[model samples]
Target: MKNASPAQMLLGLRIHAAAFVATIIVLFAVNVMVGPPYWVGWVLLGWCIGLISHWWSVRYHTSHRTDPN
Candidate 1:
């Protein structure tokens, strides 16, 4: 993992977060269009929280990193 450049890591994070948000939007839209249960909202909420933490870690935790040369 540490072998990856910072750009590579950030790119991965951007893609992963975009995909997750898109998937959550689709699931919520499907739930609304079809009907009840409303489970997608809960799932979205949970995943959103997790994504926030992941983003935070990627952005700040790696900001002060040093190259392990």
Candidate 2:
């Protein structure tokens, strides 16, 4: 994965973020339909934490990457 181009890595991260958003939306709808649950929020929180970490790592590496010169 380290050999992946910056564009490729960014696209992968974006796809992951999109998946997280979709999952959260579905979970929220399910919660509303079921009249509340203790797990949806936790699931969203956990996924969000992971998503944030991924986003940060991508951003950090993208910014820090040195030009081949």
Candidate 3:
């Protein structure tokens, strides 16, 4: 955990974010993209991504870092 480098951290973010971004982009690109059928799922997916990203950010930051005075 602590040994992971900055590039690793970035790679983690990119991989985690990829699905969220991809779903949204594809949904938007499709003209049928709409309320319950499309946007709702994507929004919920985004929320999940947000939560996961937040958790990973906090986890990696705390894991890699030493407390400062």
Candidate 4:
């Protein structure tokens, strides 16, 4: 069986979580910045849902992803 190094696994997970959160934040900000096209709202909502799902899956194993700054 192939075994993953702990550091490699942690880095892989953090990368995915970061991407998920980044997408949500970017889309949400864009929605807020650009007033109602309406569909933008839906896109943001979808991103939020995806972010939530990502968090739920990884919370126990990898609670904190990035620095505040």
Top-scoring candidate (TM-score)? 2
Q: What is the lDDT of every predicted structure here?
A: 0.82, 0.85, 0.65, 0.61
| TM-score per model over all chains | 0.77, 0.85, 0.44, 0.44
Pairs with steric clashes in candidate 1? none
Better of 1 and 4 by lDDT: 1
Task: Give one digit per residue, the lDDT tens place, for model 1 in 5-57.
Answer: 77877887898799997998899899999888788978888888988887786
lDDT of 3 at 8: 72
Candidate 4 residue lDDT tens string, 1-69: 014444655666677668866876787677778867646666657766876675465554444444346
Model 3: per-residue Cα lDDT over 13-69, one tens digit each: 677678667876676667364444555565757668796876678567857676445
Off by over 4 Å in 1: none
Q: Compose the digit string of candidate 2's lDDT tens values, residues 1-69.
A: 566778988998999999998989998888888884457989988998999998888888888888887
Q: Candidate 1 vs candidate 3: which has greater TM-score?
A: 1
- Count of backbone collisions within predicted model 2: 0
**What is the number of backbone collisions in each predicted candidate, taken in the order shown?**
0, 0, 0, 0
Regions of candidate 2 where Cα sits further than 4 Å from its true position? none
Candidate No. with top lDDT: 2
As for candidate 3, its clashing pairs are none
The order by descending lDDT is 2, 1, 3, 4
Error of 2 at 8 (Å): 0.7
Candidate 2 — what's its lDDT? 0.85
